[model samples]
Target: MSIAGQIAASCQRAIGITLARMMSRRQFGQTLFEHQALRLRMADLQARVDLLRYALHGIAEQGRLELRTAAAVKVTAARLGEEVISECMHIFGGAGYLVDETTLGKWWRDMKLARVGGGTDEVLWELVAAGMTPDHDGYAAVVGASKA
Candidate 1:
């Protein structure tokens, strides 16, 4: 596979593992809020998110985050994969085009399938730009949501 594919695949694996860890039922009570000593953790997490939202304040951050999110991950994976595979294909360009596994053709094929799996990079960039500004009344919404 090409460098793009290799990078994307590695990132996918790492992200998958992290999400898996978060979703595991056994890890439920391990949540930071579950402990009295770390009762402040919830606030800390919120602060962190708020900071992240701010840090990613412009189009650049938004675009990058959008690309990495669940919505666009597959697409990114495929694109990067294709880039890498294409280069690899170039190394053995003529022969690689016809084969499957060893030729690293699967990388580009998978990426092609994934590119349209969900939102396109352009759409995500727009979405994120739209999402940049925080809701001024968000704290109230959080309070109301918590009560329910």
Candidate 2:
């Protein structure tokens, strides 16, 4: 999850830089940032990043870190990092592919590591599902009570 968070943070920085560059260069009588469609897309990506950050914070606040919580965050953060980085790359167009000009390509390459490292997304989801099962020792009471 920590590695995933780092990926997210890096992607955020790349997205910010790309957006700033687009805003500085006018296109079609207005900067790309001024386009309603582009603005909405950026807003959605920002919200996803913020959601992942807040979820991680919530998990930390529990004091006792549970495997389920860790798995959930890992899945979310890795997915969000991949999404945000991809969007940033689209915004950058051909320039994002150039390693010398921006770290977007590097970030894109590293994002996959987050998904595969520690535990794969499928493995993490299975962990989460196991935690929710009534037969699972830790969640037995909660799951049982919900059924009644």
Candidate 3:
């Protein structure tokens, strides 16, 4: 799997862990998942994860990964993974800080490494943006569209 795919998978695992933790960990007389704010956050994370997975599937179906596509995916996956994992850590509160009690801390640290691994976000963004011209249509090119 590409680094982007690995990061996306990691984010999915973090989401699953967070969901399981929320369902079992109670606060204010109810499980953490019972809170409206936490529910909303979970929804947002789910949506983003779905989008990333969809993109990966599309790339797989194409049987080819363009440079722009890989760069965009890497940049997006790194940023989103970091944000999602960090949010999961926040949801875990102090327990997230303890490696023995929860794996959020480890996931958070691993995600940081992803951001720097394939290439920095700035470099990847430049590669993506360089192809995003009126004629080039970077998104279409990545998705293998014949025309923009």
Candidate 4:
């Protein structure tokens, strides 16, 4: 599996763990999931995960992964993995910091390595930027244009 695929799977797992914990526990006479703010953040995380999957599918269909495109996906996946897992840690509260049987702690430690793996974020960002055209249509070229 690609790095993005692994990150997506980890994000999905963290979300599941967080949701289960939230629903099973209550704060102020209501489940944590009942809170509006928490739900909104969860929705945003889900949206990001879905978009990452869409990008992966698109790349797979192309049957080619340009260096710039691969860098972009790697950077995105690593950042998203960090963000999603960190948010879950916050939602998990002090329990997240504990050394326990849960995979959250393991994922947390592993995700920090992702930023430096498969090339650092700075180098990848430079690669992505270098591929951008200077024309007015550069935005479209960098993003919406077909890889072919």
Compose the digit string of candidate 3's lDDT tens values, residues 50-117.
Answer: 99999999999999988888899989989999999889889978889788988888888888999989
RMSD of 2: 4.7
Q: Which regions in candidate 2 have their CA more than 4 angstroms from the true location? A: 133-148
| lDDT per residue (tens digit) for residues 58-90 in model 1 | 433456444334333333444554554454454
Better of 1 and 2 by lDDT: 2
- Output the TM-score of candidate 4: 0.88
What's the true lDDT of residue 56 in model 1?
32
Q: What would the per-residue lDDT of candidate 4 be over residues 1-148, giving only the tens digit for each residue? A: 2778889989998999999998988999999999999989998998999899899989899998888899999998999999999999889888886758567888988888988888899999999998976776876787766765
Candidate 3 Cα misplacement greater than 4 A, ranges: 135-148
Point out the higher-scoring one by lDDT: 1 or 4: 4
Q: Please give, for residues 18-130, the per-residue lDDT of candidate 2 as tens digits.
A: 78977886888999889889889998988887777776677667767778878888887888888888888888788888889888888888888888898999999999998
lDDT of 2 at 148: 100
C-alpha positional error of residue 133 in candidate 1 after TM-score superposition, expressed in Å: 5.1
**Evaluation by TM-score, superior candidate among 1 and 2:** 2
Q: For candidate 1, what's the RMSD?
A: 17.0
